[model samples]
Target: MAPQDRLTATFTRADRVAPTPLRSIPQLRVDGLSVSYGPHEVVTNVSFELGRGESLALIGESGSGKSTIARAVLRLLPSGGHATGRVAFDGQEVLGISERGFRPLRGRAIGFVPQDPANSLNPVRTIGAQAQEAAALLDEPDKAIRKQLILETFAQVGLDTPLRVYDSYPHQLSGGMLQRVLIGLAILPRPALLVADEPTSALDVTIQKRILDLLTRLQHDLKISLLLITHDLAIAAERADSLVVLKDGVIQEAGRTASVFSSPASAYAKKLRADVPALNPDRYAALRDTGFRSLKTGQAPKIEVSAVTKTFTVDGKALTAVDDLSFSVPAGTTHALVGESGSGKTTTVRLLLGLEGPDTGSISVAGEQITGRSPEALRTVWRHLQLVYQNPFTSLDPTWTIERLVREPLDRFKIGTRKERDERVREALANVGLGEHLLSRKPGALSGGQRQRVAIARSLVLKPDVIVLDEPTSALDVSVQAGIVEVLLSLQATLGLTYVFVSHDLALVRQLAHTVSVMHRGRIVEHGTVADIFDNPQQPYTRSLLASIPSGGNDVAHMRTRAFG
Candidate 1:
């Protein structure tokens, strides 16, 4: 089914019915909700109401008080965080209830789907055991009844082979699948209110859409009120009925999603909307022509992979990650290898970087082949290649100053002496738009976007000819991501470097890549220019990916792709 069909399918869940009836009165009400963590107050003077099946999204960047408000509503705040709010659910004053009294109301009246499914699920337990345990808490269960419900819930979220999934452990599934299992357990009890915190952040665009559609459908059918907490404006616009914009623990804006998105009342709301990245047809056209034109001639491949393959043995099970796949990267351009998690994009990068040895393959940089080479043989080649990882914080040492971090690369590669290294570090910081003062600061002292800049500066300090960027900007804000992409393009032009950019963000991919390769199950399903890939994709999977991208236009033809096929 297309997204248009799915949207129509969503209508079948309900007939635009009134919000769910409040069984007792006021489904949930928070009055003067002020929650303090130790002596520091996180949520202050917050008040909201969820009438029956209504959905109210809490939108903000990281460090906002959205999560705190959810925790206070469930009385699950961390130690020293005392909530001074009058919380009423089912006509009972929940704030006055004791711990014992609150226990029954938890899963029965309110269900919580946390941000990280890894943190929520028991790693040692099978999906069936966990789901059954969760269900048992709500009712005296027969094994058949519990298993049937579990299978039904799994299928409802579009997971294939529900029985196989139930029998498998959490580690056996992908991140998206694990999240769906967690969602199933949360809603199995049929709680009146569901609190979802960054539910789809970890999943791919396609899986994210499926999960969103499932949650929305469940909310409608079950008449369950929803408190959606996330930083994505597109997601808020699509799923939420009402929106509450928060900044620095303060309410920036609050209103219906349609009205707020159409014309935000506050400056913060306007800025957030402005920050979102949209497609640029002209730039995309330019990138498309460049890739095909460059490819037709006998120009040097930016990167060349011939007969590349990979395999790994996990827990005694042999897994083939990549299977004899090959591709090329043109000089002075971006060649993106895109796929979902476990689709071998990262494996390909690892093989190219010599982090892992391939069973059989050859990798060519510019024109020089360097595969299955000894450590000593590739050491010299690594000088011209650098890698930018997903998380900048983990990549950068907390104890090392930015100057030391950047200069260490130069020192290791023996490009410069102490004085020259110092000079190079200063210049590199400036190149990445960081100042001299920031060079002395540690990673913890900087923000997420700044930390990523430092990581880029470190990679650039060596003046590499090719940079392998692995989801470098995926974890950043849309506005910050735009800045990072601008910096990368500017640096690529100035340094005349090629990039093997690996990512799953289709919108960002359209904005960045000169050539695009869509990977599925460790195989390249579609290979073409960005325009060819997005505007006229040949492969069904590529079409699905293009369709998954959020399009607010009311064109039924445009939104025809369903969440998952």
Candidate 2:
């Protein structure tokens, strides 16, 4: 449905009726909540009210205490954390209660959905064993009945193969499937309060939408009070009834989600609203305002894939990963390959980077063929081509100093002298907006954004002509993501860098790419300039991806695209 149609459907008479009788006392009330971890106070004077069956979002960047506040409410704070406040839940004081006293209400009444399902679920145990343990909260004495109920809940949460999921361990499933399992476990007992902490941050766009929609449906159908914790302002605007914007343990803005989106009072809130790619997709407009008009005609593209096909043999079965894929990226411009997971985005990138050889087609970089190249020959191509991974936390070596990490590429290539390499290291850091002060610092000593900047600097140290960004900003906070976007644009504008941005985020693609190829099931469904792709996508799959973008009722980007795109 169109945005207007969704609004109409939402405001229909049948949908206007309230689902549950709200309690006289608010479902939860936190009065002057201050959480201290040892000597430092992380969350201070936080206050919010969640009415029965209503959804509230605590939103902010990292270290903003959004999760801290949620943890305080649920009494799940880590060691040495203390809270000073009045927390009233169901007309009873829950502040500073004993672990024994809070046990009854923890999962039975107030369920929790933690972020990072990989870290949350037990690694060694099967899903059924872990789920059965969680189902104990239902107080169902019969084991077989509990097993049946778990399967039913699993299917309810949209796990297509509930039995298969039950029998499998965590590693056997994908990230999205594991997340659905976690949601199923959280909702098994039908708790009144559901606290989901960044549950869909790691998933791709379609899966994220499905998980969020499932949560909304579960909230309404069960009449459960919800507390959504996230950094994405657009998601909060679309999902929550009310929102509380936090910064450094302080409430920057608090009000209805629509009011907050329409009229954000605080500067931080306004910046966040503008940083959301869905709400403000023209983030890098000024840098790329001229578009691809300057690219001279008759010049070959920087990267080209001509009818590339890559198939891997798994369990004696040939799996075609990239199917007749072809796209050309002009020099000094970005060409995004947008698709969901397992849609051949990574496989195509691997083919381009010479990480994997194509089965039956040719790939080229800078007019040189990539397929059928030896490892020794591919090194020459790799020197002019580099890759930026999705997660910086793992891509960068934690033990290596930042300077060493960036300088390693130069060292491996043996491009410069001792003094020259030092100067080049500083130059790369300066290019990515880093300073010499962070040279000696380790990855653990830096923030997520800083780590990513370091990763970019390392990639740039080799002076590659082409860089393949693998969902570069998907893991960072919204503001941090905007900063990264700015850095990337600045680099592209200043250095005439060519980029193959691989991602599923269409909104970010609007801000980043000059041309795009929409891939689905290992095939490009639509291919065009960014303007044609975003303004008038022809394929149904492309349209569906565009529709899934959370507009937050802001059309500034679309309006700008008509003028410049």
Candidate number achieving the greatest TM-score relative to the actual structure: 2
Mind giving the per-residue lDDT tens digits that candidate 1 earns over 1-565? 5433332353242432324563436677888888787788887888777766778889887777989888888889887889886998756788878999899878766889998888888889898998888877546345776677668778877788899999998888888888888888887766778999999877788888778777877777677788999887777877777799988788888887779878898998887776665533344344344444555665687678988888899999988898888888877778898888877898888988988887888888866667867888888778888899999989998999988898888877788668888898998889889999987889999989999999999988888889999999878766577678877877766666788899888877877788888998888888887778888889888888877775533332112223111
In model 2, where do residues sit more than 4 Å from their true spots? 1-22, 295-299, 554-565
Full-model lDDT for every candidate: 0.79, 0.86
Number of colliding residue pairs in each model: 7, 0
lDDT over C-alpha atoms for residue 316 of model 2 = 100
lDDT (10s digit) by residue, model 2, range 1-565: 5433332343242332234564457888989999998899999899989987788999999999999988988998898999998998876789877889988888878889999999999999999999999889866677877787888889989999999999999999999999999999998877778999999998888888889878887887667788999999998887887899999999999998779889999999999998999877776788874436534453459888889888899999999888999888888888999988889999988888888888887888998899998999988888899999999999998889998999998888899799999999999999989999999999999999999999999999989899999999998998999899899988988888899999988999999888999999888999988889999989998988898786665342233223222
Q: How far is candidate 1 from the true structure (C-alpha RMSD, Å)?
A: 5.9
